[model samples]
Target chain A: AQSVTQLDSHVSVSEGTPVLLRCNYSSSYSPSLFWYVQHPNKGLQLLLKYTSAATLVKGINGFEAEFKKSETSFHLTKPSAHMSDAAEYFCVVIHTGTTSKLTFGTGTRLQVTL
Target chain B: GAGVSQSPSNKVTEKGKDVELRCDPISGHTALYWYRQSLGQGLEFLIYFQGNSAPDKSGLPSDRFSAERTGGSVSTLTIQRTQQEDSAVYLCASSVRTSRDNEQFFGPGTRLTVL
Candidate 1:
């Protein structure tokens, strides 16, 4: 079985400040992790993905995440948050069973305040 | 090039009515998937299709939910005698192939409201 957990349901960061969204996963096999962002009424957009290639992965919009195997965590970080960064972010895991499927976390709603 | 697209962006139907949601995936994409997202909830996997055949229908919530893909390009999800619990945003995604590394492109989704 494969599952993901978003440690924070909501995260507040000031514009120009750092941002962090925490996620963890449980998978019987080596997992492929991803972070996706969704704006209101918009489809999900992939921010970054970790496929065991590198511990730190960089994504679009200046977002990046570090995959920590010992801790079983993949946390998203941005050096500076912009107003446009306010959106719901989901942590996803690809389950490699009979048919590959994605398992999503509840999501973290990021609020960028001035 | 066009991304995935879904029809009937919003549908409000009475309980017990049957509804069909359509999805047109990216051109040449061989793998398609259906998911349901309830209010404030995470996505629930419904089904997966590779070409015209579905090998994994285990994610379907109930027998009333059925899906079919034709010509390996378009898909339709049919809900028979829908209930209030069936109200949610139906999302469709497609990828070049079914691999852990292949990224899935998503559609705008179809919002269904059961009254």
Candidate 2:
């Protein structure tokens, strides 16, 4: 079985400050990891993904994540926070098995302040 | 290109009633998926369909939940004897065929509330 754990349920960052959202995953086989952002009353949008091709993955809106196999973690980061970045973020994992269903984490609500 | 489409953006029904949620995938995408999102449960996978292959229902919570995809395009998820706990946002997504790296495009969800 595969599962994703988000370290924070909520994070507040002032505009122009750095943003960080932590996540850890567990999977029996090789896994594909992803970060998705959801604005209020909107559908989820993929930020980035890591499928073992690269350790560092860059995404839209100046966001990125690093996959660390040894630590079993994939944490999202941003150099400068923006008001538009306030939203809900989910950490997801898909096992290498044939079924190929995505398992989502509890999600972290980011609050960007001025 | 049009994103995934889901009908009846909101629904409210009484317990014991049956409800059906609809989904129309992207023009050429062959894979569709259904999920439930609630305040308590977050997001839970409900079903998946790839082309004409049989769907994966491993995530359906119980016997009262069922779904079907026809002609490899449109899909519907039906809930029988709806319970209050069934209240949640139902989400649908579609991808370009079956690829490990394929990203899914989601539809604005249907928020269902069972009284």
Candidate 3:
């Protein structure tokens, strides 16, 4: 079975500073990785995804993630943290073959402060 | 075009009651999924339905939880004898279910509260 692990349960960063949220995965077959953000009372929005074509993936809201196969990691990063970035982030993974199920991480609550 | 939509955005029911949550997937989408999000559990896969194929319900927590999708367009998730632990957000998503990729369009989700 495939699974995802979010190393941090919560992360706090000052406005204008860089932000990072770590994610790792374990899948029996090749996997599709994704980052989704959820704001209060809002539906989950896909930030980015890695389908093995590119190691570095750029997402919406100026967020990005790099897929490191050697380390089994897909850590999300941003050059600058904005207050609007405060929300819950989830790391998701799908099995290699098509028509697969998705496995979500525990979730990381991001808090951006001034 | 309208995105995925769910009914009863907010539901409040007493314990031991049964509740039905509805989802209307995007037009022409062949794949649909149901997931539950709790306070700490993030998102838990509940079921998957594609076309007229049998749904994959391996993620269902218990027999009390069941779901059905008709005409490959709409779905309803039913919870019998709801409990406090059943209080959470139910999310529905639709996709093309292609063999090469699956990009799901998600709904706002139905927030259920069992008091």
Measured by lDDT, the strongest candidate is 1
Q: After TM-score superposition, what is the CA distance of residue A53 in candidate 3 from its true location, in Å?
A: 0.2
lDDT of 3: 0.90
Candidate 3: which pairs clash?
none
lDDT of 2 by residue, B5-110 (tens): 9989999999999999999999888888899999888999988998878888988999999999888899999999999999999999998866668888899999
Per-prediction backbone clash count: 0, 0, 0
DockQ of predictions, in order shown? 0.83, 0.70, 0.57
Docking class of 2: medium
Return the clash pairs for model 2, or none.
none
- What lDDT tens digits, residue by residue, belong to model 1 across residues A1-114? 899999999999999999999999998888999999999999998999999998999999999999998999999999999999999999999988756789999999999999
Q: State the TM-score, rounded to 2 decimals, of chain A in model 3.
A: 0.95
Docking class of 1: high
Off by over 4 Å in 1: none
Candidate 3 chain A least-lDDT 10 residues: A94-103
> Model 2's lDDT to the true fold?
0.92
Q: Write candidate 3's Cα lDDT for A1-114 as tens digits.
A: 789999999999999999999999997767789999999899988899898788999999899999998899999999999999999999999755445667889999999999
User: What DockQ would you assign to candidate 3?
Assistant: 0.57
